[model samples]
Each structure stands twice: as structure tokens, then as C-alpha cells.
Target: MRRKKGLSIFQKLFIAFLGVGLITLTISGVVRYRAKKGFIERTIKSQLTDSRERSINYFNRTFTIPIKKDLGFIEQSSSLNNFLTSQRDEALLTKPPAERLFLHFTKMPESIYLSSRFIDSKGREKIITVGKKRVRDYATIDHFPNNVLYRRIYSLFERLKEENVGSILFEGPFRYKNNKHTFVIGISKMEPEIGGFGGAIIFLCDLTGYLNYLSDIKFNQIPIAFVFRPDNHVMLSPEKEASPGPDLYQSQEENINDALFVSSSIKLGSNNNVLLNLALIIPRKIFSSELKNALIDSVLIGVCLIIFVGFVAFFISMRLFAKPIEELSRGTGRIGRGDLDYRIKIETHDEIAQLADEFNRMTESLQKTTVSRDMLIQEVNERKRTEEALKESEEKYRTQFEEALDAIFIADAEKGIIVDCNHAASELVGRAKSELVGKHQQILHPPEEIEGEFSRTYKQHLKEKEGQALEAHIITKNGEIRDVSIKANIFEFKGKKFLQGVFRDFTEQKRSEEEKKKLEAQLQRAQKMEVVGTLAGGVAHDLNNILAGLVSYP
Candidate 1:
């Protein structure tokens, strides 16, 4: 199986750093979001409570005193006794007159008043006049007296009379005789001694202005405020009427259970009509909206920042690590493809630099090894060629030796025994090469005589350290004796001493020599006869010449 390439130090380190950074970013972002959310929630809650308290204080300060002074004037007036007894001055005894008298008596800057009369002893009532006589009285009970408002007010008065208290609590609707619209009302009865009136002073209010004021006020801009009221009426906020003018006779019940209710029977005014005080409250929804906005903004900012930072970090980390790693990867590829000379060149002094150095060293060693291996291979090939030439030469020499006519024998120098003999040698010895191989030289001939000669020859060779030639006789395979001429040489080959001999089969040659010697003797005898004849002839010729010379001189 093919092995996978290993990763460089840079690659491994970059991966590790990236993983750690991502984990850290994730953990930090979550922590920041949670911390910011919690802080915003806490801040909103604190501010909302503070704002509610300040609003309530401002509301009480703005309306409470004037309302109390008006009620006080009414309690001190004895004019109500004449008006009730005559009943003819109803138009003069109502609000504008009453309001003007009270305003003058109390020395207040602003005052509002309304008057209602029960013309019949039944439940029907009419609003006589509202503040400044600017509002006209309703014609019938249908115009002013309503079930929810009139019934509740009448019950409150009855209760007040029975208990002999200055005021009674009531919750009901009140109609504006002029605008023909109605609002919820709350009335507090003024004492006869304080106002000289046996009637209730009505407070006209609604949840709209209270809730709106709570929403508008900022806590830090003013003092904090809150309200305590009945809970049931908080959920019963009435729809606002379209009419623009204030309803003097309007009555709004202050439920004791509402968060806006300040007191069940607390004196709102300095006089008899001051039983209910309206305390402002900051709406919980406003605080919740602020908290939500803060939380959302913090989360959005955190997410955007974290993403931006992470992206930058990732790119920076890659630039630091990935570029070097890619360089190393390319270097590795070159090396793997048998480019042992390839090297990584990096200037850093970190672990990657160390790795590059190690790689360079390894490649250097590999180059050296390659050179050495090539040299070794060439040496082996040369040796193999030389061995082949030597083998061929040996085969040629062996073939010539076997086919030669001369008898040749190789003997062991130390043992004086035949080591190897050619075919002719075996024939001359009258034995097979196998039989002659281990035999002593003396065994080839007559034992006593040849042994003595062989001993002399061997001793002579040992002494002179040279070749020796001698005539010898050998017995053939047919039991025939053959004469031979032997030449022996002592040689050393391959660290072993050996004796080599070549013998000519001189049996026929010796006979021819004998015949030639006999022919020479016969030729000598014939040549002597011819020489005697020639000397006789020369003596006869000299005698004949002397006789001839004597005859011619006489």
C-alpha cells in the first residue's frame, strides 16, 4: 500500500491555532451578550421605578392644593341654606356663583366647579351649571343623570349621611352637560361646617392622562414617582371621549387595588373633598421597551464585532501559517519525485526552520549515498566482465590440451603421484585417466629399475628447480612395452606445487635411428674399396710415363 505524505510543522500548528481562536471567540461572544443583557434589564427596572415616583409627586403638587381650597370654600359657605330653602335661585346658586365665591374666598389662582340638582325625589338629576356659567344645564335626566354615575354618587351620599363622615368612596361615570360626553368620576363629600353644603365635591379624572404622563416623563430629568391604587380599575381603563373640553361634573373612581391608586381614603385636598389623590406611575411597558432595545443593540453589536474580528483573525492566521505550509508542501513533492537536491529555504528561527534544516541534511546524505551506490555498481560490472573472459580462455586451453598428440601428465609435487593426465598420457600409460590419477610414477614401468630412475630424476628436479628430459619405457594397455621420451617441469600454480610432463612416443623413431646407423657402416666399407682402386691406378700411370720417356731419348 502507498503511504500518505506527512504534514509539515507549519500546517499542524496553523490548524491548532485556528481551532483555539474559534473556541475563544465563541465563548467570549456568549459571555458578553449575556452580561450586557443583564445590565440593561437592571438599569431599565431601576429607572422605571424612579420615574413613577417623581410623576406621582408632580401630579399631587399640581392639582391637590387647588382642589382642596375649593372644597374648603364650599364648606364655609352658609348660602347653601337659603338656596335649599327657597329652591327658586337654582340658576344663581349653582357653579359660577359658587365657584366665584369660593375662588374669592380661597384666593386660589385656578378653580373648576360643577353643580347637580335632584329636581324630582326619584333617581333623575340635572346639571345646573358648570364652571364660569360657560356650560349650559342639561334639559332632562337623559342628558345628565346616567345609571353608572348617578346611582354610584347617590349611594355614596347616602352612605356619607348615614356614617356622618365628611366623605364616601364611589366609582362611577359622569357626563359633561355641555359636550354630552361622560367620564368616570370620584366624589368626596364636604362637611357642613367646612363648606356649609350638604353635598359631595366631584373629582374628574381618567387613566389616559395618568398613563400618558407616566410614559412621557424621564426619571433623570425630574424626581422619581409611583402610585398606589386599586388593582381592579387598572384593567378597566375607559375609552377616551372625543370631546375636547373638561367635564367639571366628571367623576373617576380611584380603585384601591390599582397600581396607580395612592390611598383608599387618603385626604387629597386640605378640605372635605380630598379623599382621593391621583398618583402618577411610569408604565412598565416603557421600561420594558428600553430594556429590550438595549439588549437588542448590545447583541447586534457583539455579533457584528465578533464576526469581524474572527474573519480578520482567520485570514491573518492563514497568512502566517498557510503560506509557509504551502511552500513546504511543494518542497516535499519535489523531494518525493526523486529530486534529492531540493531544499526548503525559510528564514524563521522556529520549529519549521529546524525541520527545513533537517530536510537539507537528509537530502545531502541521500546524494552522497547515490554517488557511492553508482560507483559500487560499476565495480561489480567490471568484475563480472573479467570473470567471463577468464572462463572463455580456460575452456580454450582445456580443449587444446585434450586433443594434443603428445602424452602429458600433471603430478602432485609433494606426493610424487599423477594428479591429471590427457588421453595420450593415459594411452601411453596403458591405463584410464581415472586409474592413473592417484598412481605413483614408478608404477607405470618395471618396479625396481624405473623406481630408481624416477627417484634420481625427482631428486635432480628438486635440487636444480628446473626441467629435466629423459628416455623411459612404458607398458601399454595391450601389455606391450613402449619407449618414450619424457620432459618434466616443476611449476607452481594457484599456491599449489605441481609437476608437468610431456612425453613423445618414440618407439618407431628409435627403430629408424638404429637402421640409419647400420646404413652408415655399410657406406663406410664401400667408400674404402673405391679409395684403394683409385691409388693403384695412379701408380700404373706413373710407370707407363717413365718407359715412354726412355724410348724417346735413345
Candidate 2:
């Protein structure tokens, strides 16, 4: 026969430690990567949501609030109305409302107004003024009576007469005369004297400043602002020209860049009448780099950790196990190779050294043991008989413990902790023997008795050598209560005293006694009824005899 070689314990242990280390490293790496990646994604989404809210407030404040303020001032100004209606002669006042409006229009530089004008109900220009530039070089024109655009302009003026006071009308980022991105807003003017619709005060708004500010609104150094109509018409964008780009409502990849987009619907002014979509766009690449770096670092650290663990396992196994086991094997080989006086020796004071000492002692005692082998066998036989008798006694005790009708419990005398219980005890408690053992004596009593009656009785039982049969009730695992007569006796085992208890369930006997008392009471009542009936019969007989005597005398 040949020996089959297998992996040594040292080799198996090293591989096991290495495998566990690698698996742990991989799991931790994956968890860390996911946590960092999720954090980055949440941060991006949060920024986009915040941008949407800010855009709503921005449109309302920058564009809506200003137009509202202008209309409010105009509504309160009587001087402007008097000048437009031409109610009085110029001799009435030197400073006229026409001159006041022109001065206010010139000061509209900061407001970015290209031109401000007043038109009558009949499509006639009442007053007009330009800002920053002389002459009419602006994209929008007030006087275009005979041109192709005249009918369109006149139609707008007629519509202005139908619109109510404080209503605002707007037109384009359209290119007409100049290649300028401009818009015209018309506020309906009212005739307060008749309270009728009168005319319109229109302003040509230059949006170049707004577009530049829109360009400057950057996220992570990328221009994010976009202006578009509800119909997806591009108004102003970071593009060099108005070009149809990717849909900003959904996320997608493009040759230009992949981006995060958020859209918010807002009116250009205070009136909810006209809606526009304002969006912010940020490049996805800006956030990707940091997340990638975090994952790479984790993988690298995990690989290094696996390598370190493998080296530590190898070092420990060689130093602690390999050398001691090899020396023990060699020393045992010398004893087996026919040297009776040889003794195994190992310097290390570990289990391997103890094994060597055991081998040496066996070799030294071998001759003496062989000479007395028959005597040793006879002694062993006697010891076996003693053990068999002890086992038979234990068998008898176990039989009585299990077969008894009364539940029996063995508990430590001092602590009252139940150490052993019979099958009958389990049946009485409606539980398993395993469940009853290791429980306190108080467990057999009701909850109300604990810490009061049970505590006092347990203390009293500790002092007594034997207990008198006491009437009690025990609650079962099924929440049923049964009357029992219980008694305990203290017995000594190895100088420590323990309590052995016996319990007899007598709930049915108590019920029978109560029934007997009730039956005696019923018998007494029946006897009293019989005596009463006899007395009544005798009284009737006496009355009959007296009546007979009276009748005979007559």
C-alpha cells in the first residue's frame, strides 16, 4: 500500500485566510463605490431642482415686477394723461406732461428701453422718443404707414384699443430692421374721463443685456441658461445663432456633450397670460471624474489589503505549526525503530511538547505493564461490575421519576433554581422538560404571589428539612389554573443540599367536595317541606272532626 498525499494543515489554513481576505476586500470595495456614486448623483439632482426654483423667482422679479411697476406709475400719473388727451392750452403750464414723459424716457437707459412711444386709439403716434441713439435706427418702427408691415402694425394698434387697462402685450426676439434681438411691449392706455379704452404706451425693450447675463449664468463653468417658448421655439440661448438643439426636457447624449437639464415654466411678466420655458443645462462629465477616481482608489486599496493578509497568514502558520509538528514526528520514529530507552524531546512548551512527554512515559512503563497484564485485566473486570451496579440503580431512580403520576421537581436549595424535572412535571405545566428545567421555583406559582407570598414561602422552605403538604394553585403554559397539593424535602448530594418536590393535581377533588355540600343542603330543604305538609294535614283533620260534632248536636 502507498500513502496518498493531501494538503497539509498549514497550506489549507493559508489558502483559507487568503480567500476570506480577498472576498471581504471585494465586498467592502463594492459597497464604498456604490455609496460614493449615489452621493454624487443625489447632489447633481438637488442642484438641478434648486436651479428650477431660482429661475422662477428670477423671471418674476427681473421682467414681471418691472412692467407692473411701470404700469402702476402710469395709472397714477394725471400729468401724462392730460398731455396725451391735449385737454388744455400750452399757456396753462410751462412744464407740460409731454416734456415730462420725454425726460423720463431719456432716463430709461438703466432699464434698457430702446424706444418709448404713445399711440392714439386711431393708430396715430402721439409722442415718441429714443434712448442712447439719435434718429430712428431701432429695429421696431412707429411710422410705417405705406409699407408691407403697415397693415400688421395697424392691426396690432387696433387690438390695443380692445385690450383693458393694465393688460400687457408682447412681441418677439425677432429680427426686422437691424440684426438686433429686441422686443416690444404695449401697455393698454385708458381714458379715465369716459372710462373707455383709449390707446397704448409701447416700449421697445433691448434684451442684449439680458442675453449676456443669461450667458454668464454658469454651472461648473458651463453656461446653463436657456430661454424658449411653450411651443419649443428658441428665443435666446448660448448658441451663436438661434439653432434647434437637443430637447432640454429629457436627458440624452449628443456629439456636443451629455448634460443634466431642468425646466421651469414662467410668464415673461406678472400676468399669467403668456408662458415661457426657462431651463438650465450642466455637463454630466463635470461630475463623472470625481466618482471614477473614488472607485479606482477603492479597488487599489482592496488589492493591497488582500496581499498583506496572505503574507501574514503564511508567516503565522510556518512559525507556530510547521517546525513543532516535524520534530515530534521524528522523535516518535526513533522510539518505534526498536530503541526502548529513547525519549521524545521538543523545546516548545505547547501541545506538541505535551504529546512528546506522553510518548516518553508510555515507553518507560511498557515492561512493567506487560508483566502484570493478567492482574490488570482482573481489576478492570471488577471496576466494570461496580459501574454496572451504579447504572442499574440510576435506571431504577429514572424509572420512578418518569412513571410517577405526581409531578416531581429537583431544585438547588439556596437559589430555588429548578435543575431537573420529570416528564410528569412537563405535563402538569403543559410544557416540555427542557422548558421546565433551568426555571425558578416561583414559575410554578401565580403572578400575584411573586415578590410577596412566594418570596416569603421560598425563604421558609430553605430553613425546613422537610415540608408539610401545602394546598396551592399552578398556572400552566396554556393559561389554565389547577389546584395542587405540594411538598418538598431537602436532600444532601456531595455536601450541597437540594430540594426535591412532589405535586399532586387535585382540582377535580375540590370540585367534588363543593358538589357534596350543595347536595346536603338540598336534602335538608326536602325534609323540611315533608314536615310542613304533615302539620297542615293534621290541622285539616281536627277542623273536620269539630264540624262533625257541631252537625250531630244540631
Candidate 3:
């Protein structure tokens, strides 16, 4: 087998140092990435939420101001309803509210027009229009009207009665018999004093103008703007027919739905085709362009900083690692060429300096060891000779065998015949050493013994060339039985094979173990009886108390 070439101290140190540094750098980069990404996401989401809230407030303020101002004007106008009713001679009185409404339209600005209608208790209705154009002369109670404008007006009145609201926002196409145009209308129920009876004041505003005004508002540099209604209507979308162009209205609807339902931040697209959906229901009012620019700047700055830090780390690692490794390499080369006295001498406070110190100590030890190499080899040879002599001395230990405190014997494997017996063995079996010799060992053992115990042990030792040891009961010459431990080993001396059996009489140990087991069993039985007595006493006391309670109750 070929041995692999070992790495030099410098090579090993360099690899270990680089591995540690790389791991540290990787962990730091991951931590920084997660922290910075979380910060950016949180910041953008907060800003978007704030912007949407502001936009909703702006819309409410702008839309409500004009309505409030117009209501104040109507309140100050001199008995406007009476003036209109008095102007009606019987011929004018019979005029439908729609025609009379045209006369009142002259009083409004060009930006607004009025229409009116009345429904009696019988469900009959009078339709009126008071706008830039006239449509009716005398009052006409109509059961049904085909005009979209009148239908919307009727719906508004019905809603007002049901909800008791002053006005509603309605959007749709309004068609007269002669013309059709899309309109957004605000309708308010007129009090009885305003028009001589209960009726509705409908203000029609052109949808196109309102949409144009909304689009014209500067939303920073946002490329599009639109209005989304609650009913899934795109009031002013950039896409006319949904042909894949950017649809601001749809985007706003999605944002609003998320804001209202999911209440979460949503990302849409990128710079070249940037799409951002800011939830309108958030407390923030979103202006698209300003938020986009802020996010783009943040991302660019973060990326540039990350790259700069990585480059700086790379340069620093090279400077810190390369020079020390080169110096260590030269020192290692000298050591490898039999210059065991060579030492690395680099001064630093890091792991590299510690490595250099360790390398110096190793080299010093190696040099000292080289000086003592011949003496060490001679000492090892003397130890081997001494061990061999010790083994020979042990083989001639016949005196120890005879005088040992423990019983010992030599026997034949097949016949179990004792070839030799020590003084202790003779004393244990109650026979003289001379008498025990040539006697079968099984004569001192029980007949109804563990089957094959000695035979199997002898066979195992013969096959493995190892010794076997076990404890068993044997009968003595006095007919007394005792436990004895027997250790047997196969040995061949002078071409005669024999088994060396060393015996240790353990009769006293066996008696002590039997006494301990009997005491433990008695202790367990005493504990179990004590527990049973306690349980019986508790049960008797409880039963006596229950019997006394029952007798006293009667």
C-alpha cells in the first residue's frame, strides 16, 4: 500500500485559514442581505400606504367643496321655488317639470345643467328638464321614460327615499330623443319649498371634462392616471378597449381591492414597463411616479454598496493571507530537507501567528529528537530482550504454582485427568498431591452438570489458541461440594501437550452472594406487606366513617 504525501504545515494552515474566512464572509453577507432587503421592503410599503391615504383625502376635499358652495348659493336665493310657481299662469302651471327645469337651467353656470321630475302617490310621474336645451312644454305625467337621463334620475330618487341620503354619484350614458352623451350626475332630492312640491334636482356634468381634469393632475412623473369605480367600471382608463396597453383604471382597481380586502403591498412590473399597485384603501394616498423614483434610487444604492464592500473584502483577504503563506512555505521546505532546526518566525495576533508559534515548537522538538535517535533505538531493543527473558522466567514458575494461596492443576484435555496438583489444590479437594495425580478431574465434579461446558470451552480455546476461564461446582474428597473458578490454557512442553488449569476456590464468595439474594427477597416482601396493610387500614377507616354518617342521618 502506498502512503499519501502529507501536507506541509504552511499548506494546511493556509487552507484552514482561508476556509474560516470564507465561512465568516458568507454568513455576514447573508445577514446583511436579509436586513437590507427587509428594510427596503418595509420602507416602500409604508410610503405607498401613506400616499394612497393622502390621495383619497385630496379627492374628497376637491369633490365636496364645489357641492357645498353650490348648496349655500341655493339656500340664499330669494324664494326660488315660489318665484317659479308664481310665474306659472294656468298654462305655465300645467307645464311639465321638465320644461320648467330648462327655464331654471339659465340660472346655472355653463359647467352645470338641471333637470327635475316628480312622482305622485298613485305612482304616476312628471318629467322635467331645465337645461341649456328644452325638451317639454306642459306638465306631462309619464308612466315610463326611455331617456337614460330620466332613468338615472328616477333611480337616484328611489335610492334617496330608501337611504335618506342627500345626493349620489352616478355615471352612465344619457340619451335624449335627439342626442346622446356620456355623463356623471349628482342628484339631490329637493325639499317641498324649493320647487312647490317634493321633487329631485339633477345636476349633469360632462364625464369627459371630469376625466380630463383628473388626468391632468401632476402625479410626479407617473405615465398614466385613471379613475376606478366601485362597480368594476373603468371611468377613465388609458386603454380604450383593453388591447394590452397599460390600464391605469384596472391597476387602481386591483390596488383598491387589495387595500380593502387583503390589506397588503403588491408589486406589478419594472422601469421599462413599470407597474406599481398602491392600495387606495390604505391610509396613504399613492402618487405613482414619486414613489417609483425613490424605490429605484434605493435599489441602485444598495447594489453598488454591496459590490464595493465585496471588492474591498477580496483585496483585504489577499493582503492578509498571501504574504504569510509564502514565508511559511519556504520555512516548511527547509524542514523537509532534513533541516529539523528550521523555524517559522512571523509576528501577528491572529490564528496565523499562533500557527507559526506551533510550527516553531514542532521543529524544535523534531531537532531534539533527531539528536537522541540512536539512543532511543538501543533502548527499544533492550526492552524487547527483557520482555523475552520475563516470558521464559514465567514458564519456570513451578515454585509459585506449588506455594500459591489459590488452588492450581495441570490436566489432559481429552481425559480430564489431573497430571499435576499444587498444595492448595490438594487441600481444597481433601487429597494429597500424589493421590490427586492421575485421577480424572470429572471424579470431583457432579454428574448432572451443565452439558458440554468444559468440552465446549476446551474446543474453543484449542481452535482460537486462546485461554478459557469459568466457575462451576465440584465435589471434594470429603464429599463436600464447593464453587471453584478454573482458568485453562493449552501448552506444549518437550513435545507433550497438556492443559494448565489454575483454580480459585470461591465457596465463601458463593455463600455470601446467596445470603445477599435471600436478604433482598425478604426486604421486598416486607415492603409489599407494609403497603398492603396501610391500604387496608385506610379503607377500613373510610368505611367506618361512611357507616356512622348513614346511621346518624336517619
Clash pairs, candidate 2, are: none
Ranking by TM-score: 2, 3, 1
Model 1's TM-score against the true structure: 0.31
Badly placed stretches (over 4 Å) of model 2 are 1-24, 28-33, 88-95, 105-108, 132-156, 176-178, 239-257, 301-554
Among all candidates shown, the one with the greatest TM-score: 2
Instruction: Report the lDDT tens digits of candidate 3 across residue range 1-554.
Output: 99886975545655665566566555755565566556654665555445555544443354335544443344233443443345446435544443443345434554444443334222344334445455444332344555576566556445444433244444444434344234434434344444322443345544344445445533234323444433334444444463122333344323332222112222111111111222222212343344456556755675666567666656665667667877787887887787876678776567777887888888887767866787899999999999999987886687787889988778776667789878998898888888888977666576644244354444444457456567667778878988887677888877777887777888998899999999999999999999999999999999999999999995
143-173 per-residue lDDT for model 1 (tens digits): 5455555555556445444443344233432
What is the TM-score of each predicted model, taking all chains together? 0.31, 0.44, 0.33
Report the C-alpha lDDT of model 2 over 1-554, residue by residue, as the tens digit: 99898998799988888778767775876687788877876676677677667666765666667766675566547776776556447525632465466447545647666666666666666566676433333223345656323343455556666677767766654543466566666677787577676777776666666656667777677677787655677776766363436466333222234765666666553245545566776666777897888888878877887797688878877887788788778878988887878777678877778898998888877856875787899899999999999999999999999999999989888777889988889999998988878988888877855663344445555666368776777889988988888787889999888988898999999999999999999999999999999999999999999999999994
Error of 2 at 308 (Å): 9.3
Which 10 consecutive residues of model 3 have the lowest summed lDDT?
A: 267-276
Off by over 4 Å in 1: 1-27, 62-65, 78-99, 102-128, 134-148, 173-199, 203-554
